[model samples]
Target: MFRIPASNNGLYLGSVPQSAAAKNGGTLITLDHDMATLPAVGRTLTVAELAEHVDDMAGRLWAAGIRPSERVAVHMSPGFDIYVLATAVARIGAVPVMLSPALEGESVAALLERLDRPHLLTDGAKLDGPLADFPVADLTDRTVVATGSRPGAVSLDDLAGAPRQQPVLLHPDEPALMTHTSGTTGLPKLVVHSARTLRGRFRPQERLASLVRKRETVAIHVSYVHSRMYLALAVLLPRAMPLVIMNDSEPAGVAELFAETRPGFIETHPNSFMEWEELVDHPRRPLANVRYFSTTFDAIHPSTMDRLLRASERRAPLFFQIYGQSECGPLVGRGYTRKNAHKADGRCLGFAMPGVTNFRLVSRNGARPSRDTPGYIEVSTAGRALTYFGEGERFDQQVHGGWWRGGDVGYRSGYGCLHLLDREVDVIPTIHSTLEVEDTVLGRLEELTELVVVAGPDQEPVPVVCTRNDRPLEAERWRAAVADLTPMAEPVQMPLTELPRTATMKIKRIELSQRLRTQEGRAS
Candidate 1:
């Protein structure tokens, strides 16, 4: 269904720069990772200049003996450089693999082994100890190309600096990038996607863009490894849309970023938004210019949606909470405004993205639910990844008749919107529905900052909560929050930042429970 050119670079880097410089070239991006220095110290590149950088980097990689389809891993700390080199790799018709910095060291090494020991392009620190345990044989043909010190590693800086060469265009079906799932549950799974698949997956950006006017600044704060790569290269770069990027989600840093860029549109992880919800009251009013807030990767907490939308100054601004998976792009999207965010409803994730996706709900006992019923969610999208890179059996198990089985548990609302309950693996057997209880608790307990209900060791319901304003958890308030509902274990209070989370910022219940167990053991 994708009619984009067969070029490995979806839109030529040269062409993108020309479009960017012509339309909106001045100060197109401000990348921030440090809170102390402010955005001024961060890299701010105009579109006119970034064009040269892309070409120069590609020429450097080519001169360094990189070739088309060579899988390369990017383990650099998140920054503007990751995007530059990633584009250069695709520009030269090579496949770039971005291993998440969130993956545990062994998980990172395990994924590397699965990729046939691809050339590693990263700063030396990650390779030093993370993969040290892997024998040289398993890491055979391994090469480390660094921008910093590494014994025997090639210096990217030492290569030729010419960028005038035109990028090579490969077949549309040629693989463009290989990435792994955010290892929230266990070891990450490798996923492969082709140029055509990437093009079709981000097709909705045009429509999503139409929601606001052109020439507006767009802000994005998600993993540099995720689908934002496509949005940055395919959608935003061409428009010369100004961007504000933050790898660090510390509220103070994000506040300063938006204070300067004053982003008109935002797309980030759901929990990241929750972490920044405190920015609503920052003196700068960082969200003042936000016309839309878009979230995906996981369902957002109700309180998070409530505060952020209310904070923005734009009249009738919208919140787009998308429910999707890493294996597939956006499946369903629901729009909420200040007026509707507080509307009494379960955790609704919205209807399918109309023509973009088809969803099915298969319930207990292996039957498709005839009505609104909680069950396993499955989706059919044009952009589903081709397969799990090396595990053919695992890939086969996830697909049936062109529909990929989603591991999430949810139901289709009577009006066609989808309401997610939780991950099937994260199911908590509460007397009341887990989502219902959580949403209700959030609505009643405005003082509660963050809440997650997980199954305790006895398969009983337990809650982990963060109180508003750093106040100690109040047993009376916790009891009152659940008084109208059902009796449950006392909430285990913890600092919000201490919660175990996936790369995308989804709470890792299994890991969090283990941490709590460890803390208890130490206390005893």
Candidate 2:
């Protein structure tokens, strides 16, 4: 068994023994563009191999001047190398600043500028054009370790021969990972997590014993830079060999990999799961080995959950849905089984994760009320981040004392399940009353192919619905739909052709809202 020091201060996240995997005879599997084909169970690296690689990589990073507590930026595709580098950084007592490869030009540049002078570890081919435009040289004096050959870049192979160094003993409170908040409001804020906080937030003990027994083959299809990887690996590692899918995690790609790898469990975002639904012709494949599926990052529409349940042949338990923010960590999860499916109102995020956390609901208008009363959800947990980096004002407003205000308004049901109402900004207050405009729009347009609701600058709600056909939605049908609601919310039905979205498929509500206001002003 791996033994990490029980320290209240200076907790280091990567302090667990590197050789523990080798001692237990486990393995590590990774898939990337460099591989001849998707990695299968038999072809994956053994635990001994992974531990040796981590040791070698850590030594090389130290030789390259990555001192303890220094931050090393990792901008690479998901794979075995990514995990190795992350583990290596931790073993050396350095922080791993993970950046999603899917992040676009401006977001990437903004993040890089915020984390100045970081030792970068990346797949150089992915960094060719867009990253070259930035003042990379001035930002960091450190050298980059590129996985593949690139002009003026050092290769990973060169580091294998580097001399090994003693692992740094770090306190539990030391920052281990740097993650960015979802840029939902303005620029994305940086969040710093410590080893103590992560351990407390994600109680790795409960799942470890079972996971070890199964020795399950697991596939991590989400971006390693995201919080999902941290949550999944921290819980899955003691027992199973994690298969990292580095390239596009689209359904077609993931299905092909699944067919080859035969992983017992798969972890991914709801969007990727939906994409997978569209790619495969058969709802149920010969996925005899697979047993569990988990989703996070965003809420999955009930329809998408239905599709997943059907596709898995009801062979696996209901897909697990986890809800949390980058600052608060993962706070809640629900198992989507047939027994609980009918009970779900498509609103309850789930009950709290038992022991590691607790929650409170503070009214948007400032009063604490009973169940059925909607208010902003505030969470207090041991896993909450220590501080928001570079966003003092925003951080102060959101976090008061130990309670982090999650801006999203929700309420508890009589049955003790938590139901998310809407985000503070997403709620529309009409002349008569307030209403969760987005929830109503999404529920009403359930039959539509796609839909998004944006609050216009005039503070009016506009619904953009995409249907399979090009036919326009009639004025009467739109009016009737809005009229049937409890608190009447004004709806402007627009074609889907006019909507804007982010790289991760989130609607750009602010931009669309601005456009709507401009058009309304012109008409007036």
Angstrom error of the Cα, residue 161, model 1: value is 2.1
TM-score of 2: 0.82
Please estimate how well model 1 matches the true structure, expressed as its whole-model Cα lDDT: 0.72
User: Against the true structure, candidate 2 has what lDDT?
Assistant: 0.63
lDDT of 2 at 55: 79
- Look at candidate 1 and give me any clashing residue pairs: none
In model 2, which range of ten residues has the least summed lDDT? 34-43
| Runs with alpha carbons beyond 4 Å of true place in candidate 1 | 1-27, 33-42, 132-140, 160-165, 344-346, 366-373, 517-524
Question: What local lDDT does model 2 show for residue 313?
Answer: 42
> What digit string (tens of lDDT, one per residue) describes model 1 on residues 1-524?
21346334343332455456666667467777532112233467677667666677778777767777788777665566676777777777777888876666777777778888777777655666566565533553445454654566767767745445566666666677877787767887878877666765776555566666656788888887876555555677666577777777888888888898889889898878877878989999999888889887777766778789889998878888877787887788778889878773646788776777889887765766543347778898877887888987898898988888878777787798777777777776654466667778877777776788777766777788887667887777778778877677888888887888777877888777667667767887
